[model samples]
Target: MVGLLVLAAFLTLADRWAVLYAEHRAADALKDRLKLTAAPEVEIDGFPFLPQFVDGRLGSVKVTVPDVSADRITLASVSATARDITLDGDGPTSVHGARVPELNGDVLLSFADLNRELGASQVTFTGEGRDRVLARGTLPVAGHDLRLRADVRIGRAGDQGIATTIGGMRLDVGDLATYRPGARASEGLHLTPKSVTRLARETRKVRALLGVPSVVRRMGVPDATVREALRNDDKLAALTGSRDFVHQAMRVNLLDLTLAHPEVLDRLGLDPALLDALSRLTRPVLADQLSLGFRLPEPERGELWLRDVRVEKGGIRVRLAGQGLAFGD
Candidate 1:
């Protein structure tokens, strides 16, 4: 009984030793074959590995590599699990080739790394939902940094790449006082349809604009109506709350107003010199500055592809899969 127990202990230790040796050798092989800067962490699962070693088949193996530089972004982590690995040679050190019948993994693009790599425009990425990311940051506009926000949808780019589409973009006119000096733009100038609805609810700002004789004159509000609004609070509220007022305000595209009515800018205390700078900012130029498209590197053998993508709180995760993956041939 004692002899059997001792033999069992010896076998256990031997098995552990062999597994470690195999894992180290496999890691080195991967590092060299993949041209990796550092050796990847390798784990051979489903052990009592000696018998599997003899049969030249590993049931499962997991590999994790960090900080892999890609086309436009650096992948924070690249991990994969290979199944039914068939070795081409008798031993781990002697193996010159191998076959992976199935492989699955994910590449993580951490927001921290992405913010660092794509920091040229000072844009930052955050998860908006399961399949979408929110990109919010400052963009250069009219010789000043302006706030911009966009919802980016992530999807498979062809077979092996991950693609991003900017669904909608809006620029917010932060600190209206900056443009108007001592006063604020009562029109609440922002570049989107949604802002038009918001401007209607801001009765105080509308009142301020109506208070200015120049603004009321440029907007074609009657002098009698202004006098009635001043005496009757309800009338003042009704005038600003009117659908016609909202519609007209919504139609006041700053670009068109800048060209057609210099009086409007006068009420807002803006210099006409800034009109040229605003004119240069177009939808295409903003879209190009916020461009976020990239492709994955091709594999040397068999097939590799992106299966799915999800936006996580910290970053984006891309599911990857491959079949009949060959190494060291």
Candidate 2:
């Protein structure tokens, strides 16, 4: 009897050990799929993992990823769960339709970084950049060149990208005209590409103050082409009220449109053809790109699908779900 009891206890312990081991394997595989440098926090629910292993199915899976970055922007946290997962010979078989409960993405573009993009390296950041970042230097705001102290507020520009609105109302050096970003700091000031011509209708001004006309002239397409592109967009059709002649309203340029209301993109279809055209006109090598989103890499052949996008403090948390996500072979 003693021998039998001892054997049973050993089996129980081994079962628990194997469960954790399997959990780690799944987590590691997930990490690779997400392009994470470290193993994500993974948990598998169900007791006596051995039985589930033999059956080739798990009850549930939860994973926590700390950081994920495509380029300049970084997603701070990502937590997700999936039900009825299949364990495959190589690893966890592609989980179909995972649920993402919570995810956080933020980018800290220091004052220095912002300046580099603006090509105004003369400006420098002061103190910390958490709540507010102060840009101290001279910038050509509005019409006049002024030595100014600008308060930069960072927030979600739209469904994607970050927006820095400079307007805490402080001109330490010049007259009332000294701090001249525009006549009205109160107006909504957004940054987006010129090609995204729809954005100018809403914002105080597009960031095309410099050579926008030249760029627009370079890619002058007939109004007919723009109209054709809009017609192809079915999503934009469903969400908005009435679709009118929106081509003449659009000037030819190599910039993404940062609409006053970014929520519109959510309604746009997922075809990416129209957006690709708008986002592609941009010549990153020629000039500073005023993009409006995290600009994540294009998905590779059904790897994952972005479901929802929410703007939060620090960065935008985009929800993504995958059906059978596979890793490097």
Candidate 3:
């Protein structure tokens, strides 16, 4: 009996030591993968007396990297920390007090002092048969400050896409104007290129449905061709006095009227033929460019500002310094 008791004790010690060693190795591997300068400090306080398993407590770890640079901006520090770790079973783990710092100017446009006031970032993950992640953070840009909070669930079926929704967002346009003067700070900004293109299409649709004569003229379709078509086509001529006829004429001119003689259309609108040529027009440009400028208030500040941004033909350009500035968006 005495020998059996001694053997059990040795096995318990061995299991405890192995668990601690595994934890240390995992932490060290994470540090190397992240290219951090310092290894995380880990501690395990309590051991399961019955099962000989180690329970981690009062654990704190930090990793830091210095001198990160990208796109002409240099960042002085990137640091992350994990605290108060608790592991239950071999498959499930819980951690609290996780913090990660933003990458300052290296990844952002302009450096702002307000970033320090935003506080530390955090993320949490819980896994059962699948994994779920929740994250919250803040970031600063040249013209605005962003706050984000989101939750993501993984391992879902079908092409339904990950479910995401903005919890809260606040933009400080007033602060942005300080960097670029005479910019319209109050103009609500849309960051997504797809939405902007959709808006342009919707606008054209509404104009056509309303029979807006000026808009039809601007679309480079000769009003003369439309007027002549209405005169010759008996079915169309009968409906000329009706509002629906006006809408139909505009729609047809926009969609099908390709004028062979552009001069006829130009003379009708009192404009030159070159202006009515739609050969290279009407193509929506997609903009994938990053903009770094301040939103300015009225009564110009003698500083250059971005105005009237337009995306067309898979290209994005902004009006700045009294001229259109082209940039890859």
TM-score of each: 0.70, 0.42, 0.22
In model 2, residue pairs whose N, Cα or C atoms come closer than 3 Å (at least 3 residues apart or on different chains), thus clashing, are 94-324, 141-180, 160-293, 161-293, 161-294, 195-255, 196-256, 196-257
Q: What is the lDDT of candidate 2?
A: 0.44
Ranking by lDDT: 1, 2, 3
**Candidate 1, clashing residue pairs?**
none
Report the number of the highest-TM-score candidate.
1
Summarize candidate 1's per-residue lDDT along 162-251 as a digit string, tens digits. Answer: 777764666555644211111123322433444445554565655555666655665567889888887777887787676666545543
Per-residue lDDT of candidate 2, residues 4-120 (tens digit)? 999999999999888788668767777767668988888888887777767667777777776656354345566666567654453334333232223232233333334454435
True-vs-predicted CA distance for residue 287, candidate 1, Å: 3.8
Q: Which stretches of candidate 3 lie over 4 Å from their true place?
A: 36-329
Stretches of candidate 2 exceeding 4 Å from the true structure: 1-8, 29-35, 90-292, 295-303, 312-315, 327-329
- The number of the candidate with the highest lDDT is 1
- Clashes in each model (backbone N, CA, C under 3 Å)? 0, 8, 9
lDDT of 2 at 124: 51
lDDT tens per residue, model 3, 1-329? 99999998997788677657755865575557545565544443444422423343324433344533322223334333333433334432423222221111111111221122212222112222223323334334422244433333332122211122222122222221111111133212211333223323343333332244543464344676455534454533333434444333332232122244333233222123222232222211000011111232221212233323332221212232211211111
